[model samples]
Target chain A: MGTRDRIVAAADQVINELGLVRATTREIARAAGCSEALLYKHFSRKEDLFLAVLLERMPALTPAVTRLSGQVGFATVAENLEEFARAAIAFYRRSLPLSAGLLAERSLLEGFRAMLAETGGGPHLPIMMLGTYLRDEQKIGRVGADADPDAAAALLMGACFHRAVLAALVDLGPDDKAPGFVATLMAGLGPR
Target chain B: MGTRDRIVAAADQVINELGLVRATTREIARAAGCSEALLYKHFSRKEDLFLAVLLERMPALTPAVTRLSGQVGFATVAENLEEFARAAIAFYRRSLPLSAGLLAERSLLEGFRAMLAETGGGPHLPIMMLGTYLRDEQKIGRVGADADPDAAAALLMGACFHRAVLAALVDLGPDDKAPGFVATLMAGLGPR
Candidate 1:
């Protein structure tokens, strides 16, 4: 990888380990086997470096969410939900530290808001896509015709995010419990 | 309030405004109008002060939650949900600063975990209370008997918390959309 890429990767590692508060340019330079000047040559500030790291990492999550959405039609709603649940669990497990750090940093939110304005927030984008899918499902009578697709989409996505946060924050064992949680949620909201 | 209480409250305000990293004991003591030594007399460390502030704020949330739950049969589920939604919105609005600060501090999850442990973290308390009302409705054929009370409880509570967090983080408007969100979720999950 290029020096810029290495610096960004090192910043991500440092941020994950020591948190954004303590992830200094010097530490990142050390991690990348470079001088602090070289690090600053690529990024103007620590915040810029952090944003670059987030942008780099976010693309990895998009495909996973897209893949899960594609798998929705292959099985029953409950099964599809279980698949989504598992995917969410895996995604959060990998991204928790960074996600947690970002959530903890208000300045990061400014950067993220700018990124969202530019590229659409990676996490929120999936929910919008899922909203469209849910609208289609409602029209097809797979979901209740009376159901507000936008609201349903928000609920489904919100529930998944909430569950993932809970799992990451609390020590919920990774048995089939998550899948079961998703299944139960699906049952609660499934076609009556 | 006592000097110790003032110090803790000052710490809470500072942390809420400037975040945990930036909120120093000196700043807190200044805000409290007390000497740093006096501040230190009450809490040995920053973590302890933070925890104390959180504990002071935490008790307020539970009583509000319980009060909402008790309103179950006194009003229609929809009516109760609407009232709960409004209360929840107000609660979250007031708590948003604290929530944002906690997230920024990266200590919310830890505090939440501690709180949950002390309060008995299980599906039972919330489930049982809401389930009783749901069950009563189902027995009267208001809700479908096939509905899973546990699942329904999770859905209702989850939707409320999810909407609250979203409202706190994003501008969903002053209409208090939680009721609409909850209503739609209920419609999706309610008796056909």
Candidate 2:
């Protein structure tokens, strides 16, 4: 890996372990097996280094969300939601340590916000995609057209996100129960 | 307020202003007009201080949600759903800062879990309440008994929570079209 990539990887680990409050540049350098001077050579500041870590990780997340939306078939909605939920849980589980770190470091918000806007994914994309899907389903009479698809999409995505967030906090297991939960959610949102 | 409460209150302001990472014990002590030793005397560590702040704030979140649920009446199911949706939105809005702060801090999870279990609220309460309401409505033939209340609740809660989270991230309004959203979700989840 390049010096910059090595710096980011080490930073991710440090942030995960020590949290943003305690992860100093010197510690990150030691974790990367590089000198502090070398670390500064790649990134001007700690905030810049943290942003690199986020950018490196974000690309991996988008495909997991978008791929499910591309699946074809009504029978697949439950499955799609389940897969998406599992993927989300996995992503957060891995990232939670870093996320907690970033959150603790108040300085990172501006950089994080910039990254989210530039990347076009954070939490909103999934909701919008699901909303659009619900709208289309309504048009086909598969779901009720009279209802607002945006709201429905927002609701379904919200529940899944909330559960995933809670699960991340508690380390809930991923099993067949995930699909069951999604099924229950669908039933709640399905037409009469 | 006692020394402990003063410390916690200071921690809350620091957390809100600086984000969790930047809110150091030194800063908190300075904010509280006390020495670092005094701060430590009151709370074992920074995590303990954070927990104190959350414990102080989380309980007040439920009453608004309960009030919203109670507002639902015998009008069109859509009207009731709209009331629920609005209540959900307001609750989320008020809690967003706290949620964001907690999202940043991993140590707060235990406190959050305890709070949820004790108060019978938190992220899951909305979905569970909506599920029960829908189930009752279904049983009474107000909603089709064949309809799945669990799924409906998930759908409704998910949309509202998702929207609130998104709104916190982006500067979006409350999607004032909740009535339409309710209609669509109910149509899907309602009885044949």
How close is every model to the real structure, measured as TM-score?
Answer: 0.79, 0.73
lDDT of each: 0.60, 0.64
| Residue A127 in model 2: lDDT | 64
Best by lDDT: 2
For model 2 chain B, where is the 10-residue window of minimal lDDT?
A: B183-192
For candidate 1, report its TM-score.
Answer: 0.79
Among all windows of 10 consecutive residues in model 1 chain A, the one with the lowest summed lDDT is A183-192
State the TM-score for model 2. 0.73
lDDT tens readout by residue for model 1, A111-190? 65465556534455555676666565555556656666565555556555555555644565655544445444444522
Q: Which candidate is the best by TM-score?
A: 1
Q: Supply the global lDDT for candidate 2.
A: 0.64
